[model samples]
Target: MKFNVKRKVIMQKNSILFVILSAFTVFMWYFFFVPPPEQSYRQTAQSQNTAAVSESGDNKFKRADLNESDIDNIYVKEEYINIETKQYKAVLTNKGAGVLSWSVKEKNGQWVDLVFPESAPVMANFPSLTYKIISKSDEKIVFEYVSKEGWKITKTYNLSDLYMHNLNISVEKNSKTPFPQIDLKWGPGLGTDSKELKENISLTRALVYTAAKPNKLKKLKDNSEPASLCKWTAIDNRYFLAAFIPENSTDFDKILLSRLDKKHPCSVILKAAEPKDVNKKDYSVNFYLGPKGYKHLRTYDLGLEKTVDFGFFGFLGKIAFSALTFFYKLTHNYGWAVVMLTVIIQILVLPLTLKSFKSSAEMKRMQPVIKDIQTKYKDNPQRLKAEMLNIYKSQKVNPLGGCLPMLLQLPIFWAFFTMLRNAYELRNEGWILWVKDLSAADQFMQFGSFNLNLLPLIMGIGMFFQQRMTTVTSDLSQRKIMYIMPVIFTFMFWSFPSGLVLYWLTNSLISMVEQYFIIKKMRLSS
Candidate 1:
């Protein structure tokens, strides 16, 4: 008495409900993912030759309005220390021995400056000038600063051939008088990704690796996270991540916070808890600032790759995402990589696709018989269902076949959707004419606030034709409603990434061709 229920049939029967669900999912992403600016804590030590920097009470940022007289007497000879490795270029000014600019060659083959602009107060807030440069090498720079209180602070930076560096901070013995606990801060956070500063700030936030697993600091008011002693911390946006992983986190508490100021919301910050006297003076940590490439982050082994949100299909999404990058490398064109990915996936699922459609055809052929049986037992609801099952059993139609193929394909679709949205390789990469920057919405023409994106429109037309090729219900109203779904989806996808829209359009076109042949053979045989 057991019968295989076709879930795809249910979907085809309730197209209106499915359309609403799909559209809602797409709406949510448009709000969550977007881009912002960096800021620094610029207040230098209030008193010269002092290690303590006073925090400003004013929250608003302002520029000093100085004129000719202010600049005329400023004949200060400014000098800076330069460090260059195979991966990045860094300049440190004596102001605080902090980095002025840290530039790295990105996947786009351009040197991207990751430093906060001059507007930020703490852009040069690193390599704390409280320490003085005592030793230097081609790959290593060491600084030692001794306070008036006889407390010595030592900081050493070891450069490498990559975008990562090792930083070690040590303190000389001062058992007589204990030094006041100070914040070891690194800010303003990551640099801007998109031209829109507001969007960048919206996506920028502090991410911490804690015992409760990795969590993003949403509100600046949540002051407890940094004092919670997390293992590591990061400030990242859609494309890049700047992470700090301490060697011995047990010795001190860690806190990661952002100023959340409107001027530069995505500013970087690192405030560690008081240094415990473990009878040790030196502590080590690693700093990584670069693109969050899937393979690159995974190899770091510090859980940096967790920043990539794979959603429900985590493992499957990872595999498919890796394949997408692999195909992109092979074709050298992300547009073609998308096409190739669709083709490869369709080929692999061809058997399931055929099985599902065959089931659909069988049910189509049995519709008349099912109707007659229903009419024969119209008065007996129970008997009607029983007879319908008998008719389905005789015809050997699997109700679940139609849905199984779609369910199998969903993970791949979602994987493409997630990866293409933020892939840095597609940041400014273009496909055909008018389809520029696959990571953004494909706008061929813009009329002020309005845009004419041709891909989603074409994709919608393709969906319409594919629906037309299928058997439409006799009810004219339902058929009209089905046609409206394409229009709804078209508008919903208007703001989605071009790469994703391209994949969908490519998939729809292929489906249209596939259905055409399937129908032709079925007609010829009949």
Candidate 2:
């Protein structure tokens, strides 16, 4: 009878663990492994257009109605001007007085160009007209174009520290005609490499800062008529960003996004506000084209840091990342920093771990007594429940003890998961032998044509032993399923980033050690 009671309790614990494990497996599978949906560009663009129109209720705001007509019978010499700073190098062309290319220097001594080479007319308002170089210098360049109608367009670029720069545009006119529509644009796609863009295409998006927050636009869509006015607009990917921040939000409120061309599928456009007077119009924009580093973005005070999506438990993830960076500052090695953070986390959760271990250990010891009581009350279900309750009360055992601890730890696990996966600091950063890049899977050895990741395997082994120490269930089926959990996790984590796997590995090792000592101490007390 007592055996039945112990079995029921064990079954309840196993069921909870199984449910939680399965849920986590499903979550990880969807987020990390599943490929994005495949759709045609035309279908995607139409869908986006429909959604945008519906959201706006009416098309009061004009679309990015830039005229793409050729400049007939007009000749202007084209010139390319290059500007180099310690942080980045930018090339500008007199053809449209727009940026030809901007490449930011990385710590690994590699240049990550933000502009896609295939996407021409990048960040240009007038792509067809060639402008004359009015002025050129090491830090600044000015281009001017005078139309046959006697209207002049001048674009001046001023370099600033880091990846920040300023573009001042002015139009001088002597006509009663309306001011020509102007929009600064960038797109098709932006990323560190083609592979990154291809894999993380879903992460690439257009963002408009409006109403004190960012309103994100759908990817691969013709979103050329967002409803609200924006302070700025941008095209951002997983690691880098190219944004246009108007010096005065009032002057650049209309934001447009278009993916009309197959070659240039995503274009972010920031339209200039209509000038009250047609005689002269001037606009200044602070352009930021560089990494999405939290520290760097925070310095700009433009809320660019919001671009980093930290998931639901973002507050905790931010704190975890902060701690990680703090430890890295001390150790000067991210691998060592991860180890330190894991140790600190284990220490903080020690109280919950100790309580869970004690509850499970106590329940294991009460099995024999519980079985005897169940037998005595075999025919009396109500009395059996009452007696079980009495025994729990006397023993100070909370039936939910073990389950609650696991539940409480889940938030921390998810927070770390989100933080480590999106951590830009881990990219290309090496940890130890064969783990050259923490952001990539650790390939310790090659078995013929198969590569084996050593970290996840070790982590799996640690998890198996940790479960073995804590598991009190005597049911054969439950035990089998419980034992298989480690193997299942091994394969799931096989392709995960090494830094994330290292955190889990260190966690499992710590839990096993803690469980071992707890078991030893319980035996001594008995």
Candidate 3:
């Protein structure tokens, strides 16, 4: 009797394991594999339009051209700042101080303005502004800004082209001379009430520059606004790069520059203000505008390195990138790398999964007994509990062991999730047989004119097989739920990246093979 009880307990444990594994497989397939319905561009554009017009009237700026002489009425300042670095020369200007422009002489001797817009029409009244120009060589640069009170602040720094160089700013003003100041006031467009600019600064073909500053950057009031501004200074007819310091307080200084065009590698150096002696009559500051590169940005440890934004999943993204890169080097093909990596990861986890599979098979064999117990216990709960515990103790089976492997897989799955979404190395990468790009959906088979991707279909088939091989349900409701899961998963995976689908398909195939071996072993042992 005791031996029978022990056998029964072991079988019951296996049955529970089977249920859990099946549920998890179904959940993963349903949630991660299904591709959402595509959204129309017109719909997206309408949504953006609604958001842009939602702001209160006080914060909105009227569109106008900066060339109009009426801009002078706003009290703007202009200056020229020149920057020289090892690879290139650049001029930064604050033309009418309303626009910041950058012109660079490339490595191949071509002149290009990293800033596309030469003039940014004035939209608001400035409380305070400063312009600076620095030159390491005879080449000219410009800087410009407008002030409400017409007080002009311009400084220049000269450094050699050979040394590791930067431009810094330190503001020192004379208390006696009545330093440049803008009267604080409020109203729409010219005062504190001026709504954030809502214009779209086209970056499609423009050279983009990300800002670097010590303080927290202010969030743009409107999402449609350009991430940065393009402006030029008329000083010496040279153009410089300028962007608003969204949040300025106390002595904190902000830095902005044009995007890095490999041909032009000039640098920009800017510094924060420091306390000055009481007798100082004039305010002084330093500004550097030049090259945008990795080595140059690392000089200041202000998380400026994050401009790379590997993607939303930071550190995980870095690891995925490194792993993908290493795999690419080994196989000389990204698609092969993805396949090999999937196989290796699956193999590494096989031991735990094998145990889970064994546990599941044991449970499937015992499901009839569990159902009998449930039926028997319908009248006596206490007796049923006692019988269940005795059966488990005798069989030497752990109910929790099967769940451990799945719990361990969560992080690895998440890492792969981020890897597929953000790794640049996979971009435009091609795979074998009808799958041209690993980064994009498979395009070989289409529904009508729309292409039905080969990989997602393959993934759906694999998942169906995986589900069929693993699920053990005697309950009618449970069986219905299990059957529906694969169909839902198939739809979900339809639009995901082919690389991700490939990984899922490979994992499913491996699991099916493993399940086969485990089942065969169970039958032989029984």
Candidate 4:
């Protein structure tokens, strides 16, 4: 009987935690759906060597041309060259010596193309004309074109086995006249979106790291910033990223951002005009296109890890991610890694769990006497409060004991929620036979637009039993309200990523077991 009372008390405390979890989930829902405010673009000092640049209504950079002539009349047979590396395979075309397509390998051994099919070549023509391949190799490629007017353009690529690669663009003008603005544009979008894979249009956005801040471009406006201030610029979705890092800040004049329409993706343009008396101009940049893993990004030392949004409790989220990856290194499976992470967290807070258990048990022991006091003082509010304090003091029970320990752990709980939702490692990771992808819903059946996710249903059933095990209050109306929370949560988490749902489910199950053991230990001590 004592064990049952202790179990009931502990289960009652668990219900309170779930109440807090419901509030947290609602806040997160609001945060993800509501777009943030637009950021004001910075207009800092421009480079002295370059001409002034302004954005036109068509989302193109406009500058005064110095007697520029048509250079597209010369055409050569277009050819393709394949560059294969350990990390990715890229196809380049001689049409503009630009990237025709680049696909990065996912964990499931599937190639996901990063090039937006409907847009122009990722790094296409500076003059919008063909260039003949001067040199070609597995690791390096070079293309050069010379117009009849003596305007020369050359593109060089030094490939690597990793995500980071080098690109160099040089323009040589034989005549003394200044050449048109030499620029490199990477456009339209990053990775292709698929509804089946849960990739949505809202997840895609362009970002820039400047002045030690990462600014996400969400506004549909044209903006330009000094190249000297930009460390890197990127277009990324929820999982993958395509970024550009200027090797030398002085190599470019301005970094331009533009979008033709709200439906289209933003474009990034790097412009460097040849200074007077200097006939040749060179620009070098490093390109990174791969998954947004924190470990993978931190190696660049350029703050690329900022692309992974860890929320307000970022430090805790980082700790959780590090712990998660540490277990992944041992398990070799992200699904199992999540389970191990959940177990480790529960163990870490075992002491607090025990304290909360004891506090609740003490409260349960005094319930009979406390109820009598309440009935005796039902007419005198001030006397009832005094009597309650007297009983708590005499029993050596802290009124806030059970709740305070749980409150202290809210940040950790939230950190796990934020981290799991954005965890790139969980992408395409499988847990069991039914769960093929931890990053998506574990749908057992799909009826048109409705997806019947089994994990959430199982989770809801667990919550129902958890609430049924204990009554937090004797009031009939309040008990009915408490039972409704599980149903609300079941519907709320129905579409959440399976990895996050798995984490919560594992935590809930572990809490039940921990409570059982704590209750048993308490009974033995008595």
lDDT per prediction?
Answer: 0.63, 0.73, 0.45, 0.71
**lDDT per residue (tens digit) for residues 38-128 in model 3:** 1222224233322222221111222212333334433555554455554544444443222233344433344444332312112112212
Task: Mark the 10 consecutive residues where model 4 has the least summed lDDT.
Answer: 40-49
**Candidate 2 lDDT over residue span 269-312, tens digit each:** 67676777458988898889998888779898777887776767
- Which rank order by lDDT, best down to worst? 2, 4, 1, 3
Candidate 4 off by > 4 Å: 1-86, 94-96, 192-199, 210-222, 260-265, 364-372, 447-449, 520-526
> Looking at candidate 3, what is the lDDT of residue 387?
73
lDDT of 1: 0.63
lDDT of 4 by residue, 1-526 (tens): 0122334446665766677576667846644653332111001111100112223111221322322333333244578898877678988887656787898987777788887554435576542456788999978999987766576778899988888889998878765544656666665556642522233344667677874455443322347777777787788877888888888877777777766444445667676644666778777889888888888888888888889978779999999999999998999988899999999999998899778767876776677887787788878766777777777777788756777888888889889989999878888888888898888889889999888899999888887776654343654665786687778778778878899999989988887777667667767887
RMSD to true structure for each model, in Å: 7.2, 5.3, 12.1, 7.1
TM of each candidate vs. truth: 0.75, 0.83, 0.54, 0.80
Query: Model 4: clashing residue pairs?
Result: none
**Model 2 pairs whose backbones collide:** 1-374, 1-375, 2-370, 2-371, 2-374, 3-371
Off by over 4 Å in 3: 1-320, 433-436, 445-451
TM-score of 2: 0.83
Any idea what lDDT model 3 has?
0.45
